[model samples]
Target: MVIGPRQDRRPTMNDVAARAQVGLRTVSRYVNGMTNINPEMAERIRSAIEELGYRRNLAAASIRPGQTSGVIGLVIGDLANPYWAALARSVESVAAETGLLLTIASSEEDGARHDWVVERLLQQQVDMIIDVAPRTVGRSWSHWSPPLPPVVFVDRPGDLAGADTVLADNRGGTRDAVAALLAGGARRIAFVGDDRALHTMDERYEGYLLAHAQHGVVVDPTLVFETSHSSGQAVDLVARLLREGRADALFAANNRAAVGALLAFRTVGTRLPIIGFDDFEAAPLFDPPLSVVAQDVEAMGRAAVRAGLDRLQGDDGPARVQVLPTTLQLRGSERP
Candidate 1:
């Protein structure tokens, strides 16, 4: 439909400007979420749009030749998991400040689903994507062609060449947590994790190994268990491990694994010494309290968005792999 004054059509930006007593450009800038609009002018535009019941043509704006969609796509591993949920919230906060909408999708921690998620995001033609999902097995980004949109990865880094990534000190944090367990006389520590395919899990496992090597404790290969990121699976694995009678303590590579381990404790009536990878709000409130190596997820989220925005602003420099630090929170659980 041609956009003009029409009695039988919905309200348009032109109608909004007329009602607000402002220039069309001013109304356009305000409606498009430009940050420079004067407060008084913004109020008038807001009131006029509300009163006129004006709805923006977001589809047209997204496809405009010389403008951005002002939207960012975010694909995380699993939205139900607290860790990814918290990270997405942080990304949303940052996106809001830039007047950009954040569209979040979950890959369900499956590689095939991850491929589909990225493809869907690309089809939406978002300005950029913040990838917090587990990368597909082998080389990631093979599903998408070159000249892709600006992409920023978090946690596990993306395999796309020259893609910016924000990573926590996974190896170091795991090593520290494991070493502390060792120092507390906890040997035969059962190492539990999600799919070994995840880069974050690989890093955490390496840290677990490093701690054992540093302490001169021989690592039993049989003690390591790889399972999906689920508490129920963890309960089964932990129960079996407990039945075998080899586990002295437990080191969970990620929050899901940690949750699984905790659930297993309840099932088997045995609370093995455990040090988890992520920190939750109720961790300290647990019966024995929880110990964990906490990643600065909020910072990682902020950095990922900042890098993507920079790339959008024509930053063509070599992709920077930013590594943020983690903190070891020692409650009573790590001691077993």
Candidate 2:
């Protein structure tokens, strides 16, 4: 309907319901992305929203004062990243058991974007935040000050001043994999993937150094390469390293990086011993399978939720760090 000469109030759910000729519940369900609403009813709600120019009361949905609000927010670097997706599902499952609502936002791996998402969640009066922010791209938890939500850092290295963090056993895991490669008579191993700014990267690289040091081997700096974000980049970088004779064996920082290296080796008809940080779904199905240090993602998820809840329950001092153990999945990739 067109606006008349008279002043009009902002459109509410009631107005939309009236114009759509549907019950308030029907409109509410449609607006919330719930599946119960029939197609006909959803269309009617859509038309009414257009006619009445109704806007959602986001501010009202936020800020329920002086109580245990059931809402929690998650800020992830990328929704497309499988690791993040798995962790997100686990967090939601655990939170649901306690009747808390879980909402997620993606930062597209940008620090500024993550900051905006965090602020929005804060406005929504969420009890806590779980973030997958890396130390790279200038992300630091210290930037968040005053009335901050209890925050949990997962997988990525945090700002490091003091924040609750859950990470894998990087040094031990990497050291074992490198030892296996050496035992198989493979030398000239190269480390690939991830920028130097991330604590995860530092830990993995330190593991590489430790393994060689323990064996009285020296690292060739030229063999280390930082590649793209996903496994595809891993494949390309590994291919180049092999082509240039960088190393006879490779240590991939994560699953994606390992997958890339495997693909690259296959393309060049080379079967080098390879190891990765995280294991993939089709790891065992690879031509030579794939060996990896696997973190218990579900356990990590549960721990993050527990940490967040503990903070929400009024333990707001300096943050704590939690490290979880990782298991080695021995596959053909790390074998001769």
Q: Pick the candidate with the highest lDDT.
A: 1
Rate residue 237 of model 2 by lDDT.
Answer: 80
lDDT of 1: 0.86
What is the per-residue lDDT of model 2 for residues 47-109, given as tens digits with 9 covering 90 to 100? Answer: 889877787775574454554457778887676777778888889999999998998999887
CA lDDT, every model vs. true structure: 0.86, 0.79
Q: Count the backbone clashes (under 3 Å) in each candidate.
A: 0, 1
User: Candidate 1 residues 134-176, lDDT tens each?
Assistant: 6455236855885578999898777788889999999999999
Candidate 2, residue 304: Cα displacement in angstroms equals 0.8
Distance from true location, Cα of 227 in model 1, Å: 1.8
